[model samples]
Target: MTTVAEAASWARDLEALAIRISPRFCRLEARERARRYLAGLLAPLERKNGWQLAEAAGDASPDSVQDFLARMRWDADAVRDDLRAYVVEHLGDPDAVLVLDEIGFLKKGERSVGVQRQYSGTAGRIENCQIGVFLSYAGRHGYALIDRTLYLPQPWAGDEERRRTAWVPETVAFATKPKLGLTMLERALDAGVPCGWVAGDSVYGTDSAIRRTLERRRVGYVLTVTSGQRLWPGTVSDWVEEVPADGWHRLSAGDGAKGPRLYDWARLPFRGAPEGWSKALLIRRRLGDGELTFYLTCAPEGTALADLVWVAGARWTIESAFEMAKGEVGLDQYEVRSWTGWHRHITLAVLAFAFLTVLRKAAIKGRGPSRLGGRLDPADRARDSTPASPPPASADSRHLRRYRLVILAKTSSAESKAIALEAPYQNR
Candidate 1:
């Protein structure tokens, strides 16, 4: 259990991190603004809008908040670079993975720079929105979004007048989401970010340019591909059809909210594997519908199927990062419209997420809060931490508490089973 003092200390440490990196700002006002802004972001506000941020700063009005986002002389790109460095310094590992994904931000008007009727994965339909391609670093230490780039469709990229109004520089070009992801990957590599594998959904995986970019850099990846995606001699589904009964093995990708996600996986070798490299078609078959999902994998020879599956699982971490960031730190709850403002808001939001991630890790290390209560500590924690210590309560009361806990756990297990039976599991 994290005592009140410990939680307060953790918060102070997070604030100190913001202060330590604030020197990157050219002006003292900018530095202080960043510090307070980050604190506001981490606060448990239902709506972290400009007005709420100003209120947190004890201001009578939101004028300074509006100016801080629009006219402040701060370098958001520099802070982005620092965010990458901070993530790497804390979470870097030799076997860490770089996960690439895109998130959509819903908008009301067409003037929010890049907002238009587009297909949004979040909404599952066409919506007016802006999309940002993000790269997250995940390892044993933790995961956090390290780099971000906004995706501008060709229409916006070509419209000089719109670009002028949005303050988009003339040097910016129209790049597909995959292309932007590749740029972030290349930048991460050039920055000497340690990573062993890359993973993304079919949008990026099916792109030959993306795969070849990784190949040219000697980086390995476990990436999803469509059923129609073809190899040198055959399509992905064809390779899956050819896998014999003995080729498939049951494996757990990784632990999830429910438990380890188990699936029947098979790997089929490809024809064009280069020297010291291995390529394969990795497939997952759903137990209920026998539905198939394919992954085109490239790695060094003798890489375990378990590791490949693990890499595929690691890609989902970005989704979790996105969820936590948006839910806890108001990642998508921004009022920015210009190109620079969007980048600045996202960079700070991600920084706030990183702060929470670090605090969670400290909690897990036995010096911070437990999820059991989020307020009141659960009784199990005492039993866990004091296994060898003598009970402080009476023997009868201790036995009674243990009996109640066993019953509660059994009921919870039964409830989980009933829910799983009620709703069949899908690949997603």
Candidate 2:
């Protein structure tokens, strides 16, 4: 448990980071909102809704939070852009990746932007929900969602009355999740956000236009595809079925809660070669389960299987991130029904998550964890199994956010105290 002085110190650090990205005119009140809202989200409360956030802010009514989200003059996009720059500055690597995935936010009414009876991955069934395409940066250090765009279904897009009620802009039009992803990708690259690859599930992977866009941008990717998705060389299923018994190698995508997620992996040849790049069908079969998952990969020639496995495993970081955001920071606990309000809440939620993420990394840096784990400097890791050194603290910031934690799998028992306290995904 964190002591009073320690928790107070945590708030001050998070406040400074939040204030850095907060809009100029709203800094004073926004800093207060940032501190209280984040505390409420990280609090023991079951629901961090508007009323709860107001309570955290010591307000008598939820009106203040409602107004702040719906009518505040601050620019949501600018804050998002600032957060992106911060994440890149701290966690970005040339070998790092930008992961894309859509998450379902369940809603009861059709009034909410993009709400409809749709296929929701969250509920694992078709339900009335709004989907938001999110982009996360996964690197050697850590991963966090950096940006998002709510997916407005065609019904909401076509209904002018509904659009007006939700405060959706007239310029906003119907776009598939992949299209939304493409928009975010272009924005990141335009801002010179550093990353080497992109990864996503078949939803975005199967889109020819999305693949073409990545190809045009010369970005590498390891996106999952259906086994039946045909390739000129061979169907993914055909290639996986034909591989010899000795062809597979046991590798881990990354360390998980239980242990290293070990799987039998193989790479297949591509018939149609991409100009100045190579494409391969990578397959992973669960240990003793025989079930297989296929990924369509585009990268440089002779890219190590470890690298491909790393990217495949790294995609799960987004899932863990979603779990943390929703459970730890009110990512989906918003009461807003308007388009502007949804974006505003989401961007701020992401900002809050970023602050927690910085603290998480700082915890790791402070603890000086064994670099022997997969998360390490590539050259040092390749040279020997020796633990890599922690980075020097940044001169621009001084402090670490304090939170309770419990350690699990692959991590050292010695780190149990600090890792549990520092890991953003460690359950607030």
Candidate 1 residue runs with Cα over 4 Å from true position: 367-428
Task: Count clashing pairs, candidate 1.
Answer: 0
lDDT of 2 by residue, 1-428 (tens): 55686567676666666566656336577656655665676667778899888887789999988887888677778888888987886676665678999999999977788899999998899999989999999776678899999999988899989999899988899998889998998899888887778889998888777788877787778898998788866577888666665567666566678756666678876744456567888988775657889998877655556567777877888988999988778999999999989998898788777767766776766632121112346774454322233222332111111111122222111122221212222211
TM per prediction: 0.84, 0.83
What digit string (tens of lDDT, one per residue) describes model 1 on residues 1-428? 55687767766776667776787787888888888889899887878889899899888888887778878888887888888887776555666789989988999978988888998887889889998999999866578999998999999999999999998978899999999999999999999998878999999998888889888777888999999997756688777668775666665566678766656678888766666777889998764566889999887776667667778878878999999888988899888889988988899999888877766655555544333123224573454334232322432222111110000011111112211211111112
Clashes of each: 0, 1
Q: All models: lDDT?
A: 0.76, 0.73
Worst 10 residues of 1 by lDDT: 400-409
Q: Model 2, 66: alpha-carbon shift in Å?
A: 0.4
Alpha-carbon deviation at 113 in model 2, angstroms: 1.6
